[model samples]
Target: MAEPLLDIHGLPGHLIRRLNQIAVAQFMEKMGEIAVDLTPVQYSALCAVKSHPGIDQASIAGLIAYDRATLGKVIDRLEAKGLVSRKVSPQDRRARVVKLTKSGQELLQQVHPVVRAAQGDILTGLDNVEQAQFIALMQKTIQIGNESSRAPQRELGETG
Candidate 1:
């Protein structure tokens, strides 16, 4: 094959996008292997809800660095699947508090190991130490670039 006009192989953004695609594909495949219907975003949202039982939709979006508007649709899907439930927040009725249903909890319990196993596939060629180093470097890069992201992640207790 002829060399491409632009060398995407050397581009961090291109490589990151490709890695993300691989990660998502691997995660979906793992979920499929277990007969679970969950997307990476859905799983992230579910895990966030599990960690923060009364988290609001906006908070979930922030925690997962997902678009808040799109997260509403994701929450709707999870709700339809009986994985999560939303209720009017007592403190702020305008905001909806999300909590995992019993089914959601059980699904997480079953998926945890599968998800862990899928991580290895996502970084297939990397040995354990390399994987750790790669992850750490990626995390550092993400932290540095967070402010530039359309949807920046927010830690708990942070208010925008």
Candidate 2:
């Protein structure tokens, strides 16, 4: 093939962002084929709520690396869809605890295979070992991003 393209192919941030776009596209395509209509993020939040029943929004956001504001919206949508329910927390009345509804559980069961297939499609270019390695590398990169992002000025050798 000719190199008749932009220089982004060699840039990690550019490649990562492009890959995310592609992954979302693939997810949407697969979800459509299955007649499911959950955004990837919403599905993820549902899974988080299922796994951490009675969890608070802040805890779910932390688990998913999602900001509180965005996660709150996601939770709102889930509640609207009746896939999740939030109520005053017994442990902390000031906070709301979220849980999956029975309908949410059923939909999750139905959607699990489709989501798995979407993930498999995204990694079809790699063998099992390569897939595992790729995931490890991505996790490491995210971990570093999280750590450095917290103290960006420290990484830049800047003083407050």
Candidate 1 residue spans exceeding 4 A from truth: 1-6
Candidate 2 regions with alpha-carbon error over 4 angstroms: 1-3, 149-160
Question: Highest lDDT among the candidates is held by which one?
Answer: 1
Clashing pairs in 2: none
Instruction: Give RMSD to native, each candidate.
Output: 1.4, 5.6
In Å, residue 72's CA in model 2 sits off its true spot by 0.5
lDDT of 2 by residue, 63-111 (tens): 6666778789999999999999999998888889999999999999998
- Cα error, residue 109 of model 1, in Å, equals 0.7
**How well does each candidate superpose onto the true structure, as a TM-score?**
0.95, 0.86
- Please provide, for model 1 over 1-160, each residue's C-alpha lDDT reduced to its tens digit, 9 standing for 90 to 100: 9867677888899998999999998888888888999999999999999999999999999999998999999999999999999999999989999999999999999998889777888888999999999999999999999989999999876766
Worst 10 residues of 2 by lDDT: 151-160
lDDT of 2 at 77: 92
lDDT score of residue 151 within candidate 1: 91
